[model samples]
Target: MNPTATALRAGVRRGVIELRQSLTNGADLWNHAFWPVLMLVVTYFLRDVSFGRTGFTVGALALPGILGMNAAMAMVTMSQLLTADREDGTLLRAKATPNGMLGYLVGKIVHVSGGLVVDLAIFLVPGLFLVPGLVTGSPDAWLTLAWVLALGMVAALPVGAVLGSVFSSARAQGLLMLPILGMIAISGIFYPVTALPGWVQWVAQVFPVYWLGLGMRSALLPDAAAAVEIGESWRHLETVGVLTAWAVLGLVLAPIVLRRMARRESGSSVARRREKSLQRAGM
Candidate 1:
């Protein structure tokens, strides 16, 4: 078998093992449950809130967009985990092995992506029961959901990886969270993009979060809901085009950035980072 193939196989096995471990761990299990439950509660409250005279519940409208926002969050997860792994010398260890970097990347992708799917299902399953307006029985709805999610992940994860490679410390990485939150606020994750001003709408559209939310809303919402959107259509072509552009940019940047970050890693650097972490904890 090809060496790359073997590495990929090894990575997949490692990822599956880690995911299983996470499922069994108490803290991880809590993390898996908490967000879905909280979001479901929020959704329940919003189910009655009306969106102007459109005859749609504001809650029902927000659900799919929330799903999209959650999907977009896979980027944040990737960046944080990558930063942690790098700080702890995991990246350096992978750099030392043959195709270990590739294997390592494959493992992280598998782990994060698998976790994301589980999280989505958790949120989506209970959400369907709470909100009645969604097109749950339609095959097209589910299909569109799958493609948007899969593509959205593809577009978002690489950018997360690139962000991870850029930030050398956890402190520096933490700073990224605020801006991301701001972006989420501006993105159409919890509300309609068209409700915002024209310039704000354009700004939101530039980010994947907006497109991802739009795509999910397209999937689960009724045809009439498109009236709340910019073009009064799903604009599936624009969705695909924008997401593809992001995916390409991220894929191109991630490897180059990872390679550069990896070259700078050494035993001493890892030790220094660990020492600083320990000192901070002591303080």
Candidate 2:
């Protein structure tokens, strides 16, 4: 009956609608399936290849890291969607309604996070079949997968919202992909971090991508795989510590940044942006 509660419920419904649209729309469905299908194809070819004499196939080792990297990428999805919504005047329309920003943000989170879960399932289900050496039968493995996913989303999404707030245009948001791709390269998604240069390893560790990959590896890989990791251990404590730190930092900063960005939204501003986009497209 309360106003905020009503807004929250509306946000949930909006998120569910958007998610259903994503499933039903051809373009959205293709977007969801493309990456997972490509990854599966790559994994299939690598299934027989050894990873650094570990007796483990490259596909087996890369599978969990891929899962983590995809989870962390939820941030990019959130950021890009926010940029698109703003450009299209969706944020301005929300600004006109009571507690609309709150509802919009909550809806965005639900949609983005929900999409991430679906994408992960798409990859992991077939991945388990394609990759060997995964501890899929253990209760502990599933538990680790659960917590890592939850934490990874919490850690990444807020930061993504913040990044979305910072970029004013879709062009700028597209530029973000370069840095993200660079981070993935250094984050041990396709290989071990221990194999990278010392400075690159440190750089990768500073971001959530590496920690997410490491956490995934810790969860699914066997004990012997730890020998190939830095410090020759899973380092669960460090993973938690680093990811928690990022989650706290992002949570603390996102509200401030989003509020500032939202304050700048207006009917005139949205109209001007739309006009400019139309002009650019014509040019």
Model 1 stretches astray by more than 4 angstroms = none
Model 2 misplaced regions, further than 4 Å: none
RMSD of each: 0.9, 1.1
TM-score of each: 0.98, 0.97
For each predicted model, how many residue pairs clash, with residues at least 3 apart or on different chains? 0, 0
lDDT of 2 by residue, 44-115 (tens): 888788977788888888889999999999999999999999999999888789989889988998899889
Worst 10 residues of 1 by lDDT: 188-197
lDDT of 2: 0.91
Question: How does candidate 1 fare on TM-score?
Answer: 0.98
Across 173-248, the per-residue lDDT of candidate 1 in tens digits comes to 8789898998889887777878888999888889999999999999999999999889899999999999999999
Error of 1 at 265 (Å): 0.8
Worst 10 residues of 2 by lDDT: 51-60
